[model samples]
Target chain A: MSTITLIGAGQMASALTFPLYENGHEVRLVGSPLDDQVIDRLREDNYHVNLLRTLHDGIHYYKESEKEAAIQGADLIVCGVSSFGVDWFADKILPILDESVPVISVTKGMLDYEDGTMQTYPEYWMSKLPEGSKQEIYAIGGPCTARDLADHDPSFVGYCGPKMETLHWIRSLFATDYYVISLTLDVVGLECAVALKNGYALGTALAIGMAEKAGDDGINHNNSEAALFQESVKEMLDLLKIVGGGVDNIMYAAGDLNVTVAAGRSRTVGLLLGKGLSIDEVMEQLKGQTLEAVVIATRTARAVKALAKAGKVKESDFPLLMHVNALLNEGATLNIPWTDFQKEM
Target chain B: MSTITLIGAGQMASALTFPLYENGHEVRLVGSPLDDQVIDRLREDNYHVNLLRTLHDGIHYYKESEKEAAIQGADLIVCGVSSFGVDWFADKILPILDESVPVISVTKGMLDYEDGTMQTYPEYWMSKLPEGSKQEIYAIGGPCTARDLADHDPSFVGYCGPKMETLHWIRSLFATDYYVISLTLDVVGLECAVALKNGYALGTALAIGMAEKAGDDGINHNNSEAALFQESVKEMLDLLKIVGGGVDNIMYAAGDLNVTVAAGRSRTVGLLLGKGLSIDEVMEQLKGQTLEAVVIATRTARAVKALAKAGKVKESDFPLLMHVNALLNEGATLNIPWTDFQKEM
Candidate 1:
């Protein structure tokens, strides 16, 4: 059993310690500078602050200052930072890394350009690394929730990177029966699919909000919800194809979208909006929350709007994303465009 | 306003009368030979037994003996029968239809031959029509539930047929602010996509059962359910391709699959089976209930097995369907083959 070092003490990072610990690996979890409190809590009583679970005391915990020590002699490193921490990790941690030891990221994000081109996290980091560096970065996708993984629930995910051999080796080391893995070489597809799901998840969950706004509690409004879901997936498919992704990558988008719409923080954001709450009201209510879904929604809209202006794509192609952007940024009311959804062929 | 006659009084058939009446058409509801009780109840109290809601009184109700009187329509006809009533309608109702009027089916079904080739109901009905006589058969698809439609909830459906003008004409007469319609010429794609949802809905619902069986009440098991849903969609994509259907036709399958997994009777079957109940126990418990899911599951399984023998498709391509088939017919328990779902690419 080789050592595995995780560079962020976030929920996903801490939760992942279970499978690694179960696999007889010497796992080291090092917190970023902002995660000092969580690191302290974890060190004090084997309790994770965000995951809210009592983890095995055997895991080695380290603060930001101890990151170098934690990274020493690691066979595999996990880039477990959130999108907000990407630049932080790149500036502070990438300079100290061994280029030969491969890293797989749990972070799901993308850099969207106005030209209808998007870059996955792996691409972003690979560009930032020293030129001709041998480091490899992979991205994870599909409907994996931190709590579910910690609970040992069966979860499916796509492990995507450039090298098939590296992906197979990572799958061999990381995958449990519960943490089932599907490998793909199309890292951009998996990353974009997962990132797109966050915002569209918020959009799809508007059905609950729509129902609540109408004061109809008994009906699930599944007909409308399913319609929104299909439209979200259709937009995701279109966006993925535009970004040079694969068709089979739809599984990553559709599955995770369902999970997020069902129980993620994205659903709560959508529920509040569906109740006719404005952007200011929602921001005040959910203050101190990350609100990545909102961030991604507005970001994607900006990119799509730019793409539309450049004649790369049509604005009508993303009614759901545009609507969500309006809801989150422009204080627009929650009125779904039912007519825009019905396709003609 | 034109007079439109519907040839069955099932929940789906009866539920569709709301849109027809709201569109200012004179709608006539006719019972098949077996729907005498429903017809009598509708005639006596203006109530539908299955839809469980009061409908508009303007709709004319007719018994099986009064079919020809009801069919004295001017513009169009709705073959609003369930799959079970398809043969009955073809044998009894088709003989008297005026060749000039177009017939749209709310019934979702298909005939699967042992040769891995499937015939959609529209194709089935057209072939059975007398030689040299013309009857244009169309189909409706998507995530439309009877209760939601009868409640005048916002719904989106695809109106599919051979002719664009005819589909457009029917859309003008049927679509409302709430009852939205999408028009497509891929009758086979839409039909197969919808018919495939029933059995897969059963497979997707196994997550709820597995969670219940494990006594894990706190978790929604969205991961497993979403995985099952995706697997169901993937298998559907493979089968739809094999059957000469279109790729964009997945919206019909995925959306309806979500609806069925959410509230349809298929969920109950999956739940019972997931809780480790045998098919005999489930049958005894749900006796007298018309389980079209069971029928379709076994039917598709037989056809697929034959197709596999002929080297048309691999059984591994449909682990979800094959597992459901075994659970229903082969006395197998509810252990899902998680390994089988992982894709290597």
Candidate 2:
């Protein structure tokens, strides 16, 4: 059995242990400083309060202080920290670790540099690592929710990176009958697709919410939702192509976007916006919740807008993105410009 | 105002009048022989029983006997008949149609011939037209439900054909502030995509039904549904490429598929099946309702299987289509082989 060191004790980190344990891998789940209380609880009872499930006996829990021990002699390391924590882990943790160990990231997002360059989570993490560290980094993406993963419900995820061997090893280590993995070489495209999905889902959720608010409760707004999805994807493809990513990478990523729009937290936020809640009101209502779409909308819009100003990207190519950016940052109303939507790119 | 003649007094045909009337087009709505009773009701009162909407005063309703009068002096003709009726309309009605006049079809389906050739409705109609008839034919497709269209809920449709002038004319005649029309040169792809959506929706419905049956009540299977959608679109793109259609035609078509899979009757049928009902039981349960997916699944399976045998198409490339066919035709259980699913084309 391979020793898998998972850095993060959040829902995803906890849930991922199920598949590792099922595959007979020795799991060392190390919590971050924020997860100290949760780690104490897990150590006390082996039950994850957030996931509402008990970890398998083969999985071991580790506190923040046990970081070095958790990584010692580990065959593989997976970072399941939130996108915000990736930089910290790369800077503080990578310097102390052996450079030869492979790393897989479950964190999904894009980082906007002050210089207007956008880097995917894996890219940012790699750049932050010690020069010449050469750690093979793969990103796990798609609509695999923590709750569903914990339930062992059928899930599919894309394993994407430059190193095919590392991807294959990571796939073998985590894939279960219910947890299927597909590999892709388009890391930039896959990461961009997953990160942008949150913003798009928010847009679709707004449609559903608007329909409901319009008192068309019994009406199926699938057409409108589908139209928005189509537009979102079109914009995504254009943006991906401009960002030097493969358009075909969207085929793998489209399903995840659909899932998120249909029923993810991003859509939940959009639903509230559609129900006549302003962005500020919605944010107030969702107080203390980590709205990933909000962050993505703000950062991606800023990054893309900067790119557009540099003539590297065309802003008109992505109306939905601009609208979302405006809604989040400029206090723009949630009234989507349906007529302004292009039928084809 | 252009005089527009619509041959088919079904819900779609009736709903379409709202836009034409709103555009100030004179509408002559003629029912098929099967819809004689519906015509009688429509004549008795302006309210269309199926669409649950009152016909605009400008729309002139006609019986099957009045088809010639309906078409007389028409600027444009639209066939809104079911796929089965396309042949009959082409054989019986086209001979009477002015060869110079243009035609548009709102009907979405494919016809399977005994010789194993599958032709979309527009293709079948085009083939039936006289040699050198050169009557410009356009197809209207997307996630447009008759109910939503009648409600004027900001809808978009793909107007596709080889003739740009005819397509532009039709778009202008049908375009309203809330009713958007986009043009495409990909008649084959759009028709095939729209026709095949019912089958894909059924497949997705089965997933949703299976999830509901699995006792995960609050969880959204959007991921699984999205996965199925991705597979469906991949198969569609492969099939479209084989059938001389643009793969990018999928961008225009994906929304319709999403809408259909999200809320179409095909998905409704799949839901019943997912609830542990046999095909026969589900058929019995949905008696008096038109199951488009059921028909598409059987005929498409037959046609695709024949193509596979002739080395024109690969059957293994389309596992979901094959599984759906077996479940419907071979009395096979509704067990989806998720592991056998291809991640990408």
**Per-residue lDDT of candidate 1, residues A284-343 (tens digit):** 999988887987787788888888998989898788899999988887888888787766
Clashing pairs in model 1, backbone N/Cα/C closer than 3 A: none
Residue range A1-345, candidate 2, lDDT tens digits: 999999988888788999998899889999987888888888888888877788886678898799999999999888888866876787767777777888888888887876567789888777777667777788888777787778776777788887777777778898878887878888898898788788888877777887888784556666677777777766776767766877666665567677777665798888898787878998898897778998987788888888888888777767888888888888888777776663542
lDDT tens digits, residue span B106-209, model 1: 98867777676678888988988999987898889988889888887778788899899999999988888888887899888888888888899999888878
- How big is the positional error of residue A144 in model 1, measured in Å on the Cα after superposition? 1.1
Displacement of residue A94 (Cα, Å) in model 2 is 2.7
Error of 1 at A315 (Å): 1.5
Q: Pairing residues by index, what is the TM-score of model 2?
A: 0.94
| Chain A (candidate 1) TM-score to true chain A | 0.97
lDDT score, candidate 1: 0.85
- Determine which window of 10 residues in candidate 1 chain A has minimal summed lDDT: A213-222
DockQ of 2: 0.46
Q: What are the clash counts of all predictions, listed in order?
A: 0, 0
- The DockQ of each candidate is 0.67, 0.46
lDDT of 2 at B106: 91
CA deviation > 4 Å runs, candidate 2: A113-117, A216-218, B112-118, B216-222, B310-313, B342-345
TM-score of chain A of each: 0.97, 0.96
